[model samples]
Target chain A: MKPSSPLGARFRTAVLTLSLAVVATLGSVSRADVPVREEPQRPSAFGATEDAPLPTVAPGDLQGLLRNCDAERERAVAAQKLCEQDKTGVDFLGAAYAALWIILMAFFALVAIRQRRLSAELATLRERLARLGER
Target chain B: MSASSPDADLQPARPGVTWMPYVVAAALLVALFLVFFVAPRERTMGEVQRIFYFHVASAFAALIGWVGCAVASLAYLFLSARQGMEVIAKITDRLAHALGEIGVLFGTIVLITGPLWAKPVWKTYWTWEPRLVLMMLTQFLFIGYLVLRAYAKKDVAGRKLAAGIAVIGGPAVYLIHVAVELWGGNHPQVVSGQGGGLQHPDMQLTFAVAIASVLLFAASLVHLRMRHHAFTDELEDAYLELSDREDARS
Candidate 1:
């Protein structure tokens, strides 16, 4: 049989293409499987605009307005803190993933090295035995 | 013990090409992609929750591998008792050793990843959590098994001793599984009990993929390790035969 027959080459190309297509489909399917969580609506910080005209304040309304301003400031501070915590959490997650990959790869490399060394030793021993038999 | 013995040239040669490793690597890569890209970031724990996919999967693999080792060891002991040092018993012994070593490898990953995941979510690197302590003990037991096998005399006595230890330590896996429930720790039981575990479809899919990937990878490693051990045994037999023949000539 020819090593690189055109029929075999074509079959390999077709299989490769089919596999890529299947993988792409699986990726899309997984992405679509993500459940949409119903998050509670919050006021956006970016929604506050400088161009919006301020309403004329009466003497009684001025106190309520000042309280509202203080409340908004507190919410903004809380949001900032939450964002910082999320960032820190992401950083820790990244570090954990890095550590996992490094450890797994290191273990695999060690096993491969041991396997290679054993193979070489076995070969040498076999050669020695064969020479003894010849003698 | 002679060059002309029937068993002298009877050892099977290793295959020239093996595709299992490539399959395992590809599965792992797909699982990784699904974990990081497809799975949604958790609401409460944020990105840190993603670690659960691989962490839990590794733990499952390690636990299963150790249990497999124990079962194989028990089978070896049983066979040896009945058949008296047969080829099948030796094969089972080699299998037990391979599984034990693979268990240790994955168990080490679990120990490291567990701490890494814990530090971010639990706010501490190490906790004396019930499950954590039990897992550590189980890993230590298997590590001791591997150490004993490595340093012990290469004879039937050593094999029996190692097999005995494995049989004794096999129950630790069950204890580790229930430790959290019994002691009431923070470890979440996702796959068992009422309202257990993942709510999202993507999370479940990713976890399933991860578990399958690790299991297949562990199986491949065990297969390869067993082949190597078989080769080692064949070499030892050859050496013994050569030595015996030399003694006769001298």
Candidate 2:
């Protein structure tokens, strides 16, 4: 079948392209394991610095560090601070609400515009029919 | 207008000029109040879990819209070919189209809001889980229906074909409803046959309110859309009438 109009054909093509883009993006991102959240402002306690010198640790000292877990406890304390500092969850929540409101309002506006246009078109058609009937 | 003219049955009814809008507005406000202030923060996800109230509610509303579209489309298909049933057939046709459009709208909300909620909770915006895939498929189907309705010829055959699309897309909704149970995806099964997803009383109450409000709002949208369809049909009929008169005079 033919397209209703040139504009309709263009609109359909655009919609199809956008849908494909969305599907491709989703497919590519679904495989990613990394969390989408941004890292906290404070640097993490863990991860070796490229410029830092590696200290040679004695076996006894290594064993003591492993058994006492002093470094692990400090990392945990730092992790708690990092978790508290990160506001990604709250930001996402706000974004979700905003998206919802935006979509709903846009739909309402679309309906309003369609109604106004249709009313005007209908009145025009009826007036033309009245003029024809009078002759 | 003569009884035989297409415009004879095209009188516009102002469905939106009713109490439905006030009720929907009040219900939405109450639901928002319940979701934010009354519902307690979840232990694990904290405040972000609040999105669950509307996310799930939108899914419910979308399903209703799709299922209702299917039913209306079936009626239109059955009635369109019968004699002297043109008015009822037109009504069903308009209803089907309205529901189909509304389904797409709500399904879009589900798709958008789902990812937003998932980004932090699942640590990803989207996953190829069974339920998620099914929901996405449903959205595509309804979107196709709307596109077809918009571009197809304004004739009985075109309407029937559009109705067929809706009818075929109907079963996908049921499959989406059961996808979590069948495939055990990352998507949570909040309301199920076994029942136990929502544990808190406040959560359950907020969810109920949200579902009611969203569903009411969707139904009102469908009603308003049907009125628009009627006006469009009336305009077409007027054009036809004017064209016929001009031909006679010439």
What DockQ score does model 2 reach against the true complex? Answer: 0.15
Per-residue C-alpha lDDT of model 1 across residues B1-250, encoded as one tens digit per residue: 2457524554443533388878988999999999889887665555667788888888888988899899999999999988556878989999999999888888888888777766655666665567877887777778767766764435676678778888877898988888866886667667664564677778888989999999998888788788878877776777677677768766
Tell me the spans in candidate 1 whose CA falls farther than 4 Å from its real position. A1-82, B1-17
TM-score of each: 0.75, 0.79
Candidate number with greatest lDDT: 2
DockQ of every candidate: 0.10, 0.15
TM-score, predicted candidate 2 vs. hidden true structure: 0.79
lDDT of all the models against the reference?
A: 0.73, 0.76
- Residue A80, model 1: lDDT of 62
| Worst 10-residue lDDT window, candidate 1 chain B | B6-15
